[model samples]
Target: MNPVSQSRQSAIFGKRKEPHTVIIARGDQIRHFTVRPWIAAVAGSALAAVAVGYLLATSYLVLRDDLIGATVARQARMQQAYEDRISSLRAQVDRITSRQLLDQQMMEEKVGELISRQQELAARQAKIGPLLDSAADLKTSSDETIPTPAPRPDVRAGLDATTHSTLAGFLPDLRAGSANLSAADNADRLFVSINQSLRSIEADQMDRLKSMTEKAYRTADAISNALEGAGLSIAKGYGTSSVGGPLVPLDQSMQFDAVVDELDEALTALDTVKEKARQLPISNPAPGKQVSSTFGVRKDPLLGTPALHAGMDFRATTGSSVRASGAGTVVTAGWNGGYGRMVEIDHGKGLTTRYAHMSKILVAVGDKIEAGDIVGRVGSTGRSTGPHLHYEVRRDGKPLNPLTFIKAGKAIAGLI
Candidate 1:
């Protein structure tokens, strides 16, 4: 092959190739550089790595400040959110606590009110007890039975009963939760208990008042019955007696006022009956005397003749006390023809009683005397053989049987 052709062939594809060289000449000083293909490739790779590293470093330097600032801002936002949540939670807790305090105060006030009501009921019960006792002691026997009051629903029913049970059931839980419970919870429980107790007291008071009213009615009825047995009418008008009073206002419950009115009416009835009984010639003039002679037709002891005896003769010793049979003013207290040292009492309502055959007269005319008052002493001073007292019961100047009055007085005495 020609040299030029061989050189061109070597440059393109010949195996015997010259080394790649870079030459530089400066004033007869020359430098040559040879580089293998693998070395060039390694050098290019190193240059690319250094270029990439430079770019990465420049980018990091530019963005580091912004990234740090953004991170700090995000952290600050999270912290602010956490603080806001804590503040909201604190406000809710404060509201709950304030509400609990208000509730506690209200419950305490309710408890106080219940206590006051309870005290009032207790005082009423105490006052009623004595009235009942007085009515029970009154004596009047009858075959008829007194009607009992109908059963009433308890005042503690409905809400009161529920509150009672709830309080009872919650007691153990309250005790168990005492450490964790707020003041409001305890106050609520106390208020409920007081209210329930007050309700029970009110129910008891109602029952007691009913009983008292019934007893008073029975007593008044008994007195009325006694008056009827004595041949007197309660419906008749009382003579020359007048009484009146203004009705005072009472601040109380409706039920309480009703009961009190009933009791007062019964008491007034009893007083009226008692006054009527006092006016009648019912009491004994001589308590320790036996009847020597009865009223009506009998053989006269002094004259030994059949005659009508207007009065009963009571056997008594001389100077024995002779008492007035009824409450009245004395009309006559002096000696008489047949009855020596006699005394006559003019009871109201056209009734009169006489005590005759007395040894001495103690009461004078116009003297006010009550039943069983010692008006004179007994003696057989005129038309009598032994010491005795003659007692007579008259209505409108007409004689009546004295035995009836005696029996009626016995029945009425216990009530008075």
Candidate 2:
């Protein structure tokens, strides 16, 4: 064998052949790639990749259908939740609307009921008017001249007779029964405690009146009988025939004139007592009034000057409920320029209470108020500085120190 040239041997044995290089595309970059001989030898590689791609596409379509179904189910559940929320909101709205309607209906019904009650009360008052007027006339007549009997009877007898005969002497009193009017009879009928010891005192007075009347009647009869007996004895002894004249009873008449006058005055006093007894003037006491300011002199808050405070102030919070101090019919309830919101209750004994400085009025004129019932709200109104109640007790249209009545009311309220 012969040796090759150095260059040719170097070509055959010194270095291996270079591999084929390929370039791959990358975003803004280049990659070098190399192929192996096995890759070159594989000839069905494209067909295989195409078959795999078709299979993958079919699988993807099936998965897509499942995803769509799942998405639809989820969307339906969400929609149902939204519908439920809307339904709940609609029910809430319906409830609110129903409540508002019911409130309006209830208010209307209450108003109608009140109107009916007022009408019934007015009718009752009308029916009672005639009896009241008759009593008034009797009182007026009694004030006039007394009728003299054919034979002048004792004034006390007439006075005693009136007690049993006339209810004016009896009614309006709460007392136990008597042949003649008794205070206990009146108290029982009226269901009122005029006073703790009132019945006892009235019983004593009635007894005295009856005693006086009986005594006067008996004495007058005795005097008349004596005069008749004397005349009869003198006439029989002398044997004369003539009817006795008014002159014959001169001494008895003269004596009885003063007695009759005394008895008459006494009967007048009794009648006055009866009138007072029959006056069922019950003062319903309530809780003590909380005073905010005092009556008399004070500096005006608005004017910043000294002014004679006509009425006391009662400090209370705004919208604090105002209560009626006594039972009565509401004579007035509305805004008065300086009084702000005010309510006046008329008690039968010529008494009335004025409540002022209210933020809201809850009662109307002619509405009856019970003791300790809410009538309005406390407020700063009508020449005032702060929220407070202005309470005034009046007698015969005159302002009085409300504290006296207020204190008395507190005492009574505690008992009640």
> Could you say which candidate leads in lDDT?
1
Question: Per-candidate RMSD vs. true structure?
Answer: 9.4, 40.3
Candidates' TM-scores? Answer: 0.69, 0.32
Q: lDDT by residue for model 2 over 1-416, one digit each (tens)?
A: 33567756777886654566899878989999887655755646867888999999999897998989999999999999999999999999999778655544543343344344344434434533442343332233332222211211111222222332242333334333444644334323332232223334333433443455444344334333332332211111111346565654445324434444445544444344333222211232223436657776787877889986655666667888777766779999998888888988886667778888888999999997776679888888786778888877776887766665554333323222
**Top-scoring candidate (TM-score):** 1
The superposed Cα distance between candidate 2 and the true structure at residue 141, in angstroms, equals 49
In model 2, how many backbone clashes occur? 17
Q: Predict model 1's lDDT versus the native.
A: 0.74
Clashes of each: 0, 17
Which stretches of model 1 miss by more than 4 angstroms?
1-25, 28-60, 115-187, 236-252
lDDT of each: 0.74, 0.55
